[model samples]
Target: MNKNIKHILIILALFASAYNASAKDYLITDFGAKADAKTDNTAAIQKAIDECSAKGGGKVVVPGGEFASRMISLKSNINLHLEAGAKISAIANGAKYTSLVMGNEVQNVSVTGSGTLFGNGGKFTIGEEAPNRPYIIFFKNCKNVLVEDVHLLQSASWTLRLFGSEHVIVRGVSIYSHANLNNDGIDIDGKDIIITGCHIDSGDDAICLKSEDSTKRVTENITITNCIAASNCNLIKMGTGSIGGFKNISISNCSLRRATESPFHKWADKPDHYIGIPISGISGIALEIVDGGVLDQVSITNITMTGVQTPIFMRLGSRKNPTGSFKNVIISNITATSHSRMSSMIAGVPGFNIENVTLRDILINSQGGGTREDAERKVPENEKDYPENRIFGWTIPASGLYVRHASNINIDNFQVRLAAPDARPALYLDDVKQLKATNVKVDGEYIIDKAVYKANAVNTSVNQ
Candidate 1:
């Protein structure tokens, strides 16, 4: 061999040896961490993580035991691997860490294994007036992060939030957080994220995407698929916290249903108020650009929903700014059963219309009891108010789908039915233009403005 090649080969061997040494596992128990569930192991766990990171990068292993901690901060190039049967219980009170586990401005970090992280949520106060509680796992400004195959339980606040992070993947995780109010399951507020094969049951929104004003991060290029979400609030939602907006997002092959437990139902003092029977969820899917931001290029398909108040809700309202843009959204292959009288809505403010939206291959089986007086009642333009399906009223003018202040809308292969009779129109469109429909079948009337209706280009059938 040439002398230069031999020297290079020797250098590569040394590098590999160093890497293997640095990547060894450092057990938390070896660092004076007791796992009897009584001792606070915050310092011991942090010590292990700090030493592992200082030596380069490695796995900080939490062995099979019940360990109590306040909060633990993770470092770059470190993996917090929880062994199976290991349970980390958060301390009941803490003023130090706002989150049970946090990583800020870190890269190549991961929390992977089949262990459990339990937040002592029952110890915290319930209701919106209660003090702010700590989040379960929060990573801010992180890159190349992975969280997989872990069970997160009983979070006081949001569970598994990634804010202003990129190149993140959260897969095959299980989350159950019904302890208190605002216990969202997974919140993604970043770009280039993939969240797949997760099961989430929460007291609030199950899978939510947000770009809050404080972050100013455009949540773009995100994909979510093959997830089961059960929530008292929205199963899948975007915004109500938008400032930099959302773009190029896709969600498919997801299941949405009501939460199993409604412990703090409507912030009541009673726990398990809706026992034996879970209440219907607020919405299966909701998209709202209430704050000043643009929501564009979103596609959702192959979704199934049950036990939800509303199947779909899209709103463009003025919360902080006067107006925001919601356009180029396509939702298809949806089958839903809504139990409430409120209709699925696609609405915008009076002056600003949601544009270029399409709904195809959709079917809704609604529990309809809309009276004639309900159909004739005028819907309010609550443009500046908070966006929700019941914001307009309990019974919208339309029994199946209600659309207003939208333009260039298309509905194809759509059908709506009721378990009982409904006096309201099955589909209602107001202040809409460039409307197109094909193979549309409704059990009741189709109340559409002539200005927005296309004669031959659209086909519709109604049964009264």
Candidate 2:
């Protein structure tokens, strides 16, 4: 053999050996960590993590049992693997670490395995006037992160959140946080993130995406797929927190439903609060770019939803300035059932029309109790207000779909049904331009009251 080739082969072998040597596993129990829930294992667990990080990083194994602990910090190149039937129960006090598990500026970190992280949320105060409670898992300024196969329960705030992180994968996790205030399942405020094959039941938004930062941050290259979201609030929501822009997002194969839980049975507080909703008074899928952020190039498909006030909501609002815009959105293959009072709203503020939106292969079944009085009522722009479906205050003019201040909008293969009596039009368009609706049907056989109602619309066509 050539001597040069032999030298290269020997160098590769040494590198592999060193890599394997650095990736050692450290058991937390070996470092004076107790498995009994009665004992405080915070110091012992932190010691184990510090020692493991000192050893060039590796797995910090928490074996099966109940470990009562405060916040645990994770370091670089560490995998915190919880064994089956293992639980890490949070100590019911102070906001020291701000979360049960936290990572900051770390690389190659992961938390995996069939275990549970319970936050004991009853110990928390439960109103918006209170301070923001900590999440179950909160990480920031990290990279190459993974969270898989874990169950998170009863967070005082959001269940999981990532801010300013990259290359994150969260899969096969179950999050249930409906017992308290701001109980969102997951909030991602970063780039290159994938959340797939997860189940989330929450009182707030499930799978929320935010780009809220003082300085500009771009939330790009994100994908969410094959997830089940049960929520009392919006099932899938992006941006009422858009200080930065969002780009290149795709969401597919998702299920959205009202959470099957009750406040009396689940929470048992003094004043009854609903933990979950049998029918959500919120939208199923909501997107907004209100706080001076550009939102563009989003695609959502294959969505199934039920028991929502509105099936979809899209808004390019003006609550803050620079006055951001939204464009180039595509929605396809959506099936939804809703107790719609205000219709599925899609509108941009004046002078900032949401541009180039396409909806294809959409089917909606809605409870239609809208009267002619409600239909004739003019909808408010509410540009400076917080962006929400109910923020408009009253019912919209349409029973099925309502759109305003848009351009180049296409609605194809769309159908709607009124489950109850509705005097409103099936679809309403106002201040729209270059709109087209093909193969659109409403009320089974009718198209407008039967067709569409248009006002100040230009260059529009509808073929039933």
Candidate 3:
């Protein structure tokens, strides 16, 4: 070989050796750590992470034990693996646990294994009573991430939150929260994410896709499939915190159950506050393109839900500064049953209306009656305080589904059954243009109520 080629071969050999060394897995118990299940194991885990990072990247194995700690930080090229039977529990006291795990632009990182990460946060107190704190695991500005096979329990806030991340996968994880005040299971505020095969139960939204504020940093390409969400405020909700809008999202093959909160005791010191919000449903699937952004190309299909209030809700508004519009949305193949009253609304500002929205093959069974005379009594009450609130959309009575100030809307194969007799119509559309309802049935009757179509009527019909 030539002299230059020989030198290049030597350099290549050195680089290959370094890569092999960096990819080697490092054991945690080797660094003077005990998996005895009683000792404070935070230091040992941190030491293991430091050593693994220094070695250029590797797996830090947590052996079988109840390793108690908080805020476990992950570095690049590192995989924190908990072996089967390994239980890493967080300290119960708030002071003992760090609130969050700060990410440092790390890539190729994972927290995986059959073990469990139990946040013993049920013992902590928030507000007057105990409130769930933030996430048990938080990753910010990360890439190439994997969090699988972990059981997260009893979080005060969201169990796992991914913020500003890319190429992320969350699978086969179970998250549970019974306290229900602020317990959301997995909250995604990033881009290019897939969450599949997870079981989530919380007091609030089971899976919330959100953006903190409106900065035009859109969250896109999110796919959620084969997940079970139950006993949540909403099974899956998008944008109560949508400052920046969302795009290119799909959700399928999910089962949702509206978890019934245990009745509150009047004599108890702290009573649960049930605020009446539109999105506070058992299987409430909402897409609100509010906060000055555009929501486009969103689709939801093949959802089976029981014990839900409102199964579908979509609202678009420029609350203070209306920046964009909501267009090209579709919802199909949804089956829902509810004991609570169902309410859904789609509305926009005067100039900008929700456009190109479709609802198809929906079957709902509601126990609560629809749009009673007493429900319309709120109009006069709102006029007493703020009369302008009565002008926008308040004169329109509440219904199972309310569509106001929208255009190009279609509702096909929509059916609803009430448990009791004398139930009203299930479909309510008002102030909408270019609306079509084919094969729409309410209690096996092909009827279109004139009061629902009296607001802004244009080419509205129900085909038998």
The residue pairs found clashing in candidate 3 are 126-130, 126-131, 132-156, 180-203, 231-259
**Which ten-residue region of model 1 has the weakest summed lDDT?**
449-458
Over 4 Å off, model 1: 1-22, 94-96, 266-278, 443-464
Instruction: Arrange candidates, best lDDT first.
Output: 1, 2, 3
Total backbone collisions for each predicted model? 0, 4, 5
Cα misplacement distance, residue 309 of candidate 3 (Å): 1.0
Worst 10 residues of 3 by lDDT: 381-390
Error at 367, model 1, angstroms: 0.6
User: Candidate 2 lDDT, tens digit per residue, 1-464?
Assistant: 95324533453353334334546678888988888788889998899999988887777888999998888999987778899988998887664458889999987788888999988776777764457477899889998788999999998788899999987888899998866778889999998788889999888888899997778797888889899998877899998789897899999999998876644222213222211224463788998898988889999999999867788999888887768888999999999988647678888988889899999999998776667777777888888898777667547778777889999999999888877777778778999999999988777433224557899999999898
Q: Across residues 82-107, which tens digit of lDDT does each residue of candidate 1 receive?
A: 99999999898645467889999988
TM-score of each: 0.90, 0.91, 0.83
**Per-residue lDDT for 417 in model 2?**
86
When superposed on Cα atoms, how far off is each prediction in RMSD?
6.8, 6.1, 8.0
Q: What lDDT does candidate 1 reach at residue 227? A: 98
Q: What is the lDDT of residue 375 in candidate 1?
A: 76
Instruction: Name the top TM-score candidate.
Output: 2
